[model samples]
Target: MSVQALVRWVAAGLAALVVSAMPMAASAQQPSKSSMALANEILDIKGSLQIFETVIPGVVEKSKATLLQMNPNLFKDVDAIGNDLRKEFAPRLAVLREEIAKIYATRFTEQEMKDTIAFYKSPLGKKILTEEPNFVDRSMAAAQDWAVKLNDEVLQRFRAELRKRGHPF
Candidate 1:
């Protein structure tokens, strides 16, 4: 496989591994009828428990960039590779969304799930629902930058303390 194809394949495998690691309290057995119904309802209202529509594409694009950076010569047809990656991941997304909905059902009571669905269905709630992914993406990016700086300072302080204790690097 080309570098782009190889990276996408690895990423898809990792996503499966991460999803498999989701808590299986409810998944350990068949879901109750009401729970299954509620899970379906929740999926209908929210589409997914987590934002994959934008996020997955973003990651794939980033991976494409990284792959090109590492070996630009290997993928002469970037668009074809991108389309292939999307096609590969598209089928798996539905299964992923259903799995996430089931996980949400296990974590929340039926009533709570209904309440959430209702909130998302409301007008202002609809606006929030539409804007939330973008808001979260920006907030998370800022947080990651902040965390990196904080981590560096914290690590330096701890290392200094260790050196003060007569430890050598």
Candidate 2:
């Protein structure tokens, strides 16, 4: 795939991952009876999983933006594409949520999940949860810039060594 396409794919994957890793709230209203039970709490009914809620829609928006950039004329109907994208992906959300929760259930003990939930409900935890998307966006940009610079430096050295050995790209 083209670099832009790969980057967009990776960005969307990372966004979904980060959202999945987010701890569920442990407030009294959002308490979980068990780890298994917690695993089933895809949403807490009061918009508690706001971050999770954003994953699909955010990805859809990003996909639309990338398509527009790639072929502005062809994708001039961005709203139509965006709607179709949402329709295509919306059905798979439950499966994704179940898989994420299953992974969480395996990785965390009942008490640990509870503790994590509690932590996320606290002031500092809530702040972190709320700001995670912004953090991820800035970090991804910085990392991509660094990777491009580092890749160029490394490739220059490698190509020079290869040319010295009578090989060229």
Residue clash pairs of candidate 1: none
For 113-161, candidate 2 gives per-residue lDDT tens digits of 7777777778887787667655656676788899999999999999999
* Per-residue accuracy of model 1 over 110-129 as CA lDDT, tens digit each: 89888888888899879987
Q: Could you say which candidate leads in lDDT?
A: 1
Whole-model lDDT, model 2? 0.64
TM-score of every candidate: 0.54, 0.53
Q: Candidate 1: misplaced stretches above 4 Å? A: 1-23, 53-89, 155-169
How many Å off is the CA of 69 in candidate 1?
9.5
lDDT of each: 0.69, 0.64
Q: CA lDDT of 167 in candidate 2? A: 98
Off by over 4 Å in 2: 1-33, 40-89, 162-169
